[model samples]
Target: MVAIEFPLPRTTVPPKTGPILPDVLRSEWDKLRTVRSTYWTLFAAAATMIGLSAILCGIYVAQYAHLSAKDRALFDPASFSLTGSFLAQLAIGVLGVLVITSEYGSGMIRSTFAAVPQRLTVLAAKAAVFAAVTLVVTTAASLAAFSVGQMILSSKGIGVGLGAPGVLRTVIGTGLYLAVLGLLALSLGTIIRKTAGAIAAVFGLVLVLPTIAGLLPGSLSSVQKFLPSNAGLALVTGSHAGKTVPSLAPWIGFGVFCLYAVAALAVAGVILVRRDA
Candidate 1:
């Protein structure tokens, strides 16, 4: 039998082995930990939240005499002002977007895909890592902001306790909302694959559109109720947002926001699975 001649490959190679899921997760954890921005973002989240809270708490208590009777009776000012998360969420959303966008920006995504082969696994692992880390940190920041803020308020004789009805919901809800919103931004990053665009999308959703919606004529201000960020604000306030916006009960508004986040993440997952890295 004549031997068939074949072109030899240039380099000798051994068969590659794929990583187990646990190993992949550990690798991802290491990657997240090693990033300098991770620490900075966490610090900023805590600082901005606590700092704003302290400042607001001082103002509210010091100016107690200037406030109206209705403001004194219904205000959860401790929770309201301490919920710096309304702005701090920008940091969280940016962190989430960077989870995927950083790799794409730096050309590391190809290596990540090569190591995992199943690209979906990589995205899932990243989400798992991101959500886990964010939930813990955001929860801690929420608690710390609330505690410190209330201490200042109480010193001035104006604050509520967690045991008070609806207070716990506002504190915990802030954490949950931030975590979900971050994941939503992460999904957009996957879909858009560009950092600037992903950030703009988040800002547009949370800020620009809500302001624009309010500026429109009658019932459009009512229409702003459906927007995700504004909807989330309703979860914390027992009266302020409740009186003006078309809010469902607090938990119900949160549920609607959850639906928005999940749908965006699902669409991104499908695209990530089908697309080339």
Candidate 2:
């Protein structure tokens, strides 16, 4: 029987997608924004930055007359307004560490790796998402802190406007410093893969290392300025040279700080690819 043979339906396989970076980024953003810790940490950072700035500015206004002439002369309203960044860094750093380490702690990382397969893409997405959020939030907090602090300072006739030399740079650099600091913490978290260990490592680099550097012999003490926190702070504080350990130029110091984060992130990517989740 010569039955008309109809061609069998061809099942065409869909073309494989090359890069999933956008999808991965969206996933990472969703994960980050949905977590309770994310909101709490971000709130803590913003609160500390703006609240402490206001408090410090108020104190200075009250104590303005008691200060020595040199103290008054050395008073940098811009730098003083950002004093909260010291504490804010810890909160932001913890958030950064948690961003990756929490997944590892909960064994979600395995699922994440299974889903993405491209480990480097996962890592890059996490860094990019976290960095972007951190920059926006911290920058807004910094601007608020600067504005509030300067308003308080103005009551004492000591406020510097945004147009003042280095005021705008310091305000913006504070955010950049915090964002990069968060990236550094994320890299540490990726490398360590443990929440506590990664946090300790982050704080060690940011806080302890500078202290240790300070204890070096006088000739070696200059090394403090090159450390990550100190280097980043130079930009935020807008200090090139002063009674403190001489700082690198603002941009130079920030560049050195960024290199440290980049180097750590590179190591993290290598280890992430080589190690099992």
Candidate 3:
């Protein structure tokens, strides 16, 4: 009898594996970079910051001789250089909102969630990617603005170097503030899930709340310092000798501002998990 040839059993090798967070981060980064809004918003932010800073510094230089003694004495070159941040924050906020909301608007978030399954991880990944990119871009923009503004102010022999007291901190803090502000907007976008509504909410938080807080009477007005915009701005403004309104210490104010973003993200995470996508 002839024996039948025995077949060899196939050996299966398991696919290589690694940490999930890194994969998620890479995916989120890809998504962020591919979007047209990312380029537009970032360009707008950088341009607004550099352009406005240059223009304002130039104006200050031209009018330096006409300024009052008190005004000149009280001027803060570092803070003034970063004034463009005021408008740049809006652009940053819009980009932040779009980072998530665009996916929601197009129903792509469902696919994203389906792939990740762990909704919080996806949110965290998005935040991580956005914060990293925003921090890099804004910090560069802040440095450029500071340099350009200082160059303009130097024409009048009033410019301070990065070595000056608080100058470096102010430059770095402007970027930090804007980065955190963008995170706040991203958190709001996650919560609202509507591009228009989330953007409006971000604008309201950054712009309207401050104005409303300012309008409050007497002791109530003190609450402004606790608001996210004011608190973050305190870090950028550094420490000034005289002010009609006093702000919290730099790091203290930044901590408060961070708390607001943390709280918003916490809420968004909960809602994302507990509710339908």
lDDT for each of the candidates? 0.81, 0.92, 0.91
In model 1, the runs with Cα more than 4 Å from the true position are 1-19, 238-243
Number of the top lDDT candidate: 2
Candidate 3 matches the true fold with a TM-score of: 0.93
Summarize candidate 1's per-residue lDDT along 40-125 as a digit string, tens digits: 87778778888888887878788888988887777775466556887788898888889889999998998888878877677778
Best-fitting candidate, scored by TM-score: 3
In model 3, how large is the Cα lDDT of residue 177? 96
- Candidate 2 lDDT tens digits, 93-124: 99999999999999999999889999999999
- Pairs that clash in candidate 2: none
Pull out the clashing pairs in model 3: none
Tell me the deviation in Å of residue 213 in model 1. 1.8
In candidate 1, residue 28 scores what lDDT? 85
Could you estimate the TM-score for every candidate?
0.88, 0.93, 0.93
- Candidate 2 Cα misplacement greater than 4 A, ranges: 1-18, 240-243
Candidate with more favorable, higher TM-score: 2 or 3: 3
Q: Of 1 and 3, which scores higher on lDDT?
A: 3
